[model samples]
Target: MTAQTTDTVLYRGEDYDLIGLIAAEPITPQDFGMTPAMISTACYRGYFCTYAIEDDRLFLVEMTLRERDGRYLPIGGIQPVADAREATCSYKDLRIPVDYTGSLRLASGFVRECYIHMGYQKASAFETVLDFSLDAGRIVRVHDRSAEAARKRGAFKKHFEENVAWGIQESFDLDMDIW
Candidate 1:
């Protein structure tokens, strides 16, 4: 859709459903850590899923909940964003970590993982895995290769990325606190 179009799916989320949530903000070039010309916005919906567009690309962060007075509070802004320290994979040169407790799962039973930070020297990375079927080509042999931190990190990233993504998409309990 054109940026000027009023009807759009990629909205900044400032409607009635997003009243209490934080509105999308500009992610300046400095926010991306490379160029000073790139720009994006951090948008929220019903206190969930903060995302932005940087140079026409969609970027998201991992969301986590912290216990506060018997309640779980979201840590990475209104929607979830990725944390660099949580998990990572070795396949990529930069080794982007998985967002939101490591990994997220999809309704199709596919696992999705994210890594790297927006502020990193390079673009972030993502992976999709198929765990339910042996025929799926996404499966990797990590049990023995995960001796290094990178291998272990990649495996964990895939595992949880699938779970969280699935939970969010299905509205069920792979991850409850964030979705």
Candidate 2:
């Protein structure tokens, strides 16, 4: 299995990979009346979204779609390009306010030793983990769970090293599984 591509989020002036589900009403290519072509096994979802948190509110900053010709097109938060060849030209960045009123998990500083070959890496594999609670796109609370995640990651690493005989560690769940 290929490692899946992750969505990104800009929070507190830093970029973090979004973990697990995105929002209560997750945006998709179909949302824009478009069908995306598979770019690669890693991006089977055919599209990826870039989100940002500004003024305590969440916004969908960008959306890139994979075309059948293997060309990635920025369909959202971009100015219309008269010429297809000028698509690479600079354009204004726009933000679409998202109506997500739920929890979001952001992670960064991935530990290479805890790398997984398939799917998204577990939250525990990251050196930093942040849990955010939002109300209608506005961040109501933030939890810095990095320390707790680090502890879990350390335990997983030790177990993986001791049980090297188990071969590749496909996935690690922080809340479930004994090790």
Candidate 3:
């Protein structure tokens, strides 16, 4: 939501125009799977800047990423249900990548999940836990218990169960390079 202007002038007895580049929206909703249920909020934002010249033009490009995390409740508005009908599991504080601010043609999305170990260096201590991409969605029934640890072996133990909401949670955008 910033302003940019171009100027035209005669330099060295030569006439020329300096046309500024077009500004594009940096975020959008579709980047995430779910739509805005009720007012959406941006959970996080990141930006990368570069100063470079190309084709005799000075350019300042920025890459930005935004996250939207919020969900709806069931009927009473206090609790959350997948839908008003209560068919699917209710989600809370869903996170989605915001693609509303950038060019619709160059948006990107992805998800990654990994485990986190709670206790290490001790035989009795619990270790290894599953960690999902928060920007991807919400999860439930995921926990790390000592008994579950005993059942599993290897460097990966500390077991936990989880589910995803598939709601819009996070996203990133980058400027296209000509070269």
| Tens-digit lDDT string for candidate 2 (112-142) | 9887665567677888888888877788999
* Predicted candidate 3 versus true structure: per-residue lDDT over 1-179, tens digit per residue: 11111122222333222211123432223332323322212212221112222232222222122213443223213243333242223323332222221111111010112222221111111232211111211222223233443344322222222211211110011122110
User: What's the CA error at residue 142 for candidate 1, in Å?
Assistant: 11
| Ordering by TM-score | 2, 1, 3
Better of 2 and 3 by lDDT: 2
Worst 10 residues of 2 by lDDT: 170-179
Q: How do the candidates rank by lDDT, highest first? A: 2, 3, 1
Clash totals in order: 27, 0, 26
Better candidate by TM-score, 1 or 3: 1
Sliding window of 10 residues with minimal summed lDDT for model 1: 1-10
Q: Model 2 off-target regions past 4 Å?
A: 22-25, 67-92, 154-179
Candidate 2: give the clashing pairs. Answer: none
Off by over 4 Å in 3: 1-136, 155-179
